[model samples]
Target: MPSLSPPPVDKPSDATTAQTTEAETKPHAQPDSDEPINSLDPQPIDESKPKSNLDLVNECDSFPYFQSTPQLYLNHVSTYYHLRVAAYPEITLGYVLPSVAEVLRGLEEWELDDDERTLTLKAGDDEPTRSAILARTTAAMREIGHFSILKGWRNELYPVYGPAPARDLLFSIERAASALFGIVTYGIHMTAYTKSESGELKIWTPRRSKTKSTYPGMLDNTVAGGMATGENPQICCVREASEEASLPEDLVREKAHSAGTVTYFHIRDSRAGGETRLLQPECQYIFDLEVPSDVEPKPSDDEVEEFYLMGVDELKEKLKAGEFKPNCAVVLLDFFIRHGVLNAQNEPDFIEIVSRLHRKLDFPTA
Candidate 1:
């Protein structure tokens, strides 16, 4: 069957137009009154060289910038904020609360110091109440158009794991920004593999539904989702298995095995503005399920479009061809490494690839 491509949906243009108008109205003084004012001319463009598969893989396996590090390429000055009550280092802001004004308006538990631009949770606020307060704030942001609900579910709190005594919760989807605040967001990814009658290994992969806001139509693991508040990694794996694929609870519970984890820190441009950046520090709890040869996965939820059982060799070729989602590729790479498909002798940069798979994020534990 021919591949079905979903129609493209245009992003809302109102905010962009408003920002452009505001920027245009800002007064610009002529450098020299004596000299005729000249319009800014566009500079010549330098063509970028194409990246190899190794380069692309390495690019995905990168670390987030430290708060103290300068991002000179940004058009505007970047600001770092900190939590006043803790000795945590300054954190670069991302999507959750863009500015101090919004932060003050949305969260009642948070106290913001205008002079220092730091925010802190109210003293003596317990975890249960803090979670309740954040949920209310998230709802208000959604109502006022500051945040969009993803996947049609109410915003959920996700746990941020640290070294010892430090534990906190942030909205599940907003964990990207939470990570920028030096928190660790945990998730789960499960791969279903089977052996064909001819004795060839095959892996089941799914195409993410096009309705997904991020990485729509991209290929993904058989089952995956963020570990939500009050949910353990194993429970998350079983839940995602049933949701993303039509796997029965008994099958998932019986066949799945803990396969280790993949951790990484990634930085990317934010939708808020060109100068804004998103820091994502994440760890995925990996699970492997060996299914019967005759059993095939069917999409049970809107998260997955279709499932395909491809030969291991074919999956590797597709992975190298950049067909899978960036993070999903990392998960698959981890699988290949463990299964002996990828080795130091076969892949050039094996040590670097393995090292980058586990990034050391400086989560504030003190």
Candidate 2:
């Protein structure tokens, strides 16, 4: 395990800034600051606009620097949060970034106001120290091959659809004229399946976490996790399943069944804490996983309590009762309707989509 402590929030002083050197804000330094606009980096900011000067303290707070320090894994949380540069197909060092342990000793430590929230780093003993920390952290991340500690701090933050990188890494953003930080969101659904006595297949439903970020204490499909910076949908599936249930990577990778791209562009879940900065927009990439009926499930206590197995009629009744999370309900119904598992008589929407797909494949309509 790497050190979880981040520096306390404070601006570097003349002794800190003057003594410390600034890193070159290379396009490759940040999580989403890559070569193309459509790439991982945030969209370009129009710098032709005017600037504002509102401050009494230091400027470092406006342009925070992290040592690409590995984020701390808080107690009881399954997800990992830490800063690193964005991961991409570029190269400065070969594969295998250095461990955070290598640079841990050199970091000047500080603590936030005793009762304040959000732990941050405060180390810039000198320009060389600052430069060395940033540069070395960048290089270490480059070697580790997990993520990068973004370079350019002065950029505009923009709204994006999914993960920052096609991988899972962390970065920091400070208030700047360029708007350094931004947010990404994700969603998941589990499609449990079993063979009927006659050899038909189906799915199972689980109860949601009463303590969940959204739709607390309701029933759900399986599990889901947002794609962090440098992550992908398939990766989200694997990660979410692992967090929610004891799903082996192989099963998630199997791709036995799929309900592609069920999304809600304006969905919001207020239960999500500050990790999402409370901007739990209605955004997610939904998927359905049909598992073998007899395959017992292992769920995470932090996320779920328990679940039940039900056939089409039972599931439909649950759906009508509005017992499941709205998004999960959408994905589940879509899954059954997609796999020919359901009769497609649920509503006009199901009938329409089913008929369209069946006819597209030249199959006789039921």
Model 1 over residues 212-296: C-alpha lDDT tens digits? 7666787898888888767888999899888778898899998899998888755433321211233455788999999987778
Using lDDT as the measure, the top candidate is: 1
Q: How many pairs in model 1 have backbone atoms within 3 A of each other, for residues 3 or more apart or on separate chains, i.e. clashes?
A: 0
Flag regions of model 2 displaced more than 4 Å: 1-184, 199-201, 255-258, 267-283, 341-346, 351-366
**lDDT by residue (tens digit), candidate 2, 65-136:** 132211110110011012112222111110010122223334444222211111123554333343344444
Compared with the true structure, all predictions reach lDDT values of 0.55, 0.38
Poorly placed runs, candidate 1 (over 4 Å) = 1-59, 64-79, 83-102, 105-108, 113-117, 147-153, 161-182, 197-199, 268-276, 364-366
User: Candidate 1: worst 10 consecutive residues by lDDT?
Assistant: 12-21
lDDT (Cα) of model 1: 0.55
TM-score, every prediction: 0.71, 0.44
